[model samples]
Target chain A: MRYVLGLDGGGSKLLCVIADETGRMIGSSLAGPTNSSYNTPEEIELSITSVISEILANHNIARQDVSIVYGALPADGQLSISTITKNLHDGVKVNLCGEYVLSLFGAIQEDYGAVVQAGTGSFAHIRTPKTEITVGGWGPILGDEGSGYYIGKNALMACVRMADELGIFTILQERILTYCKQVKMRDLCTLIYATPSNKQSTLIASLCPIVGKAAAEGDKVAIDILEDAAEMLFMQASSVLKLPDVEARFPLTVAGGVWKTNPLLFNCFSTKIKQLFPQIDLRYPLFEPVIGGVLLGLRDLGFPVKAKIEELKHHFSAYSISADLFQ
Target chain B: MRYVLGLDGGGSKLLCVIADETGRMIGSSLAGPTNSSYNTPEEIELSITSVISEILANHNIARQDVSIVYGALPADGQLSISTITKNLHDGVKVNLCGEYVLSLFGAIQEDYGAVVQAGTGSFAHIRTPKTEITVGGWGPILGDEGSGYYIGKNALMACVRMADELGIFTILQERILTYCKQVKMRDLCTLIYATPSNKQSTLIASLCPIVGKAAAEGDKVAIDILEDAAEMLFMQASSVLKLPDVEARFPLTVAGGVWKTNPLLFNCFSTKIKQLFPQIDLRYPLFEPVIGGVLLGLRDLGFPVKAKIEELKHHFSAYSISADLFQ
Candidate 1:
């Protein structure tokens, strides 16, 4: 009757799941922002401890009675397990991994596919039986080349250019200048630099539909921006798919909001990726990474999950969101 | 000894200037957001009072002693002097004029002409001896057809579309999606609906330059967006110039940051406007609107401001801004 606890931590919130050796659900809990990259290690530990405590309290269990605890954390730069465990206390046996790993595990149960995690940043990691290739996680300042932040940042830059007359004004330019209160191009630069972080990215990303509406209306600029995104993403993915040791018939699971939302872009991506790696197989994730974290925890405790995967998949299939949940 | 006060009440901050009969600067002040449309009269009054009081105290002048007060208010949904004057207290003669008017006055010293304003929103206004025909001052939600906010909003909407596969993915799309922290396109809909305001517009508009850079690098989408903006703005200006009662050769003074910053757009605008209104003339404001407000105030007070305009303009001419001033 060994119990395992699994947690998925995010910048805004956290989700925890508890289960027994047979992968039977015991209880679950949620908490506030627990990503170490955002919050301090102390904050992360406290949040995890509090959520774990709440789950145990709700289920009438003791922390000492737990069999094993496995969690994927927001790694700063590396995915070394000992480093992640060091961020926590000694009572728990933790498996160290990057945020993308949880997303990958959630997307596919196998160990040989690629996951493109596009959150506040962008990263693509391909895992093979013998090796893994990672590319394009340079953060918003340098790269995150095809991430939302990058897109949003670029959009703001365009607005500023339009305002300044440094560039031509498109329908997109007209809308952004009017919407952002950046009547002056210089003000656009000031307001942006004055912001605290990549919050601007969030703001820009929210206007996806407007861009679509404009593109639908035959705005060449909007369509071109979208096309460039697909090409860049494909290019990034190719860098990993074309590795010398990479398999010719590798399976790639598309994960990320961009892949899930813009089907045109997705089609573009699929076509581009297929064009580059003709032997690649693609599949969508059955469950969210949060659930994947739970499965991983149960697996670490020697619990069988293949059967549970189908059971849960069938149970939640009705509520399943077909879009990629890679954030 | 008549004195005039010019006020540029804006979103992020409020600017005030005091000039003598000849537009010679006497004093100046600054305050926080005083745009009454976005805030309460009381709040605006309080903010303005703090700045005014401080300036008067520092300059050793009395409010009542000032002969006239001219304000370029964010209001003027329809020109109502009483509505604007009602917001201020006794002792100051209020000439409730449109923000565009002051912007125009700041640019060109004429009572009749046209000015295009694109700040948090975009609008075009034509002031003739008989009537003032405003082309597109509708707020971000309604019109703002060619503004920074509009562009930013469109960019975000594009991301949402990408998230939902309603559109294709471009470099801009992927960049924006990563910025919004939304794992799915559905989440973008939620976040956008959660908060839609000028602040969000500003955030989105900030991405304009990045779009420009991409366009410069031969990103077709970015280039198309710029072209569209130029066309929209040209059309807006044409709409104002083509009014039935207006003369074909009315002067056009570009007031807002959009026309002032973007040389290519302005050149395009000039060419397009000239094509439609052969007699159209362009005027660039040499001084900030605060100076215009002060000069207007002096004139209203029957002060000999003919000489002051030059001195004040000379002083303000050296004011250099590195970036966009809008909030």
Candidate 2:
């Protein structure tokens, strides 16, 4: 049987799955961060290849046996997808597809749909089954208007303010300061500016929940900051949602730590979304988005997926069922 | 004739003067930061040598004939008069005296008196024409409770707070962030924590007048921040004023940019000083503190400074003089 591969590259971790033409996911592997944001192109290639190679070896599948590979990865500068594809194709052979193509393909079982991604970066992509319309994912420099990084960044600013006035010091600043190992405000400022990566900032942002917790406890200041963050996110989401030809039931989903952990943020996002687009059908993703990769791989190889989705689900059902696997 | 060299080192700049044994000024130079808080010992030495070498060369003065080189520097970390003496003596021949000795020598002129130094770093020093006691000047970390760096640091923090959302966007953030070229709040937060040097912060703090202007235009938050900064300075001056042996009518002089530029701060400091030590005679320094260094150098050589002060003043009276040169 013809086989297909799906890869989901992330900043913190990478996931890959091998599925049959009939939609049965037969093998899988997990590894370190594959997002080019975390690793260089060469490093990303090595990481992606290692996971793909291991899964192929375990499943006794030769490179030629795989008909297609669909991968969704955060963009790394430009031609990042092609660079990754070239690396993957160097040893593991397959017809490699584009990043957004796979992410969109996974979201809709159809050959064409839209997916607004909000993970380490944020972007919106629309496909009429052939061409894709993409907007805004400039990685906090030019864009990323409202993402976890934005929320996390603003939360830090809040903590810094409170700390300066000896205003009710929250656990967020204490934890972030401890994590950063900066006792004085000056050292903290230096490290944040001098350090090359936004990685530590992301970690700092992961503490946005503390801001939420404070807001939940009726901190007017915290509430105001989070509300402002929500407003920025809403404005960006609206701009993407109203783009030309995005269908009424456009698949608008958030995939990031900020939205997942902060229920109030989710409520805020949902309320804003409803106010903007009443007909939008929002669905909690049924499978880890890597499954979108599997489905896209099947579609890319011209394989039927409706009946195969059942078999693919049954095969990965064991891994997905463990719930603790995510933990 | 023996030449006496006086060095006034503070947060912003170093002022050095060369005077004859009779306290008659010969040549002088102004250089960038000499406080150890600004650079490493090696850098400080290099900077000092560059200025000192220039002065000695310009005046055709032999290094060995310069009887004593006394400096009043921000006493922080490992910077002490003895440390400076060893550093200068490493390549040059001269007697090096402590920072406080230079201040006391500059202020009282008679080898006895107290001086409150509030520059990049702050401290109070008293000399009984014999024994000396100093309070504060613990750098920006342990002490410097009411120094310009302290006030400036607090002001930058207020800017960070206003940027995060009091729903009030003030000009302070724009100025600071533009200078720093930092867009993200996290970058601002990190830069604030990383203590670059008291000199760097002092430079940033030089922008406080801009913040004050913003306050005058009715930025309640900015006004409140300046008020708090003034109170801190008031307390710091009070801390120095309370030294046990420092008697009433002991000349209390305010030296430093903050004391000169910030009228509100000066008013608050003056009001508090009078309230706490009514009998303490306030002396508006007749010259810049670096001249006090010149006075110190002459006095150390056993010059009758009381009579020579008149001679030096008559010769250099037309020149904008630093009283600190004598003390």
Give interface RMSD, per candidate.
14.1, 11.4
Candidate 2 C-alpha lDDT tens digits along A264-297: 6656767877887887765443355677777767
Q: Cα deviation of A176 in candidate 2 (Å)? A: 5.1
Predicted candidate 1, C-alpha RMSD: 10.2
Model 1 lDDT tens row, B232-324: 777677777767777755778666554444444555666776676777776555656666676566666665555555565465554322223
Instruction: State the TM-score for model 2.
Output: 0.55
Each prediction's TM-score against the native? 0.62, 0.55
- Residue A126 of candidate 1: its Cα lDDT? 83
**C-alpha root-mean-square deviation, each candidate:** 10.2, 9.5
Local accuracy of candidate 1 as per-residue lDDT tens digits, A1-327: 667766776666677777766766777788766654457766766776677768888998766656655566663323323333443345667665666676777677665678766555666788877788676664443246556655555555555444433346658766765777777545555555455443555565554545545655777666666677767677667766766667666777756555545455566667777676788876666666666676777777766667567765654353234744323
Best by TM-score: 1
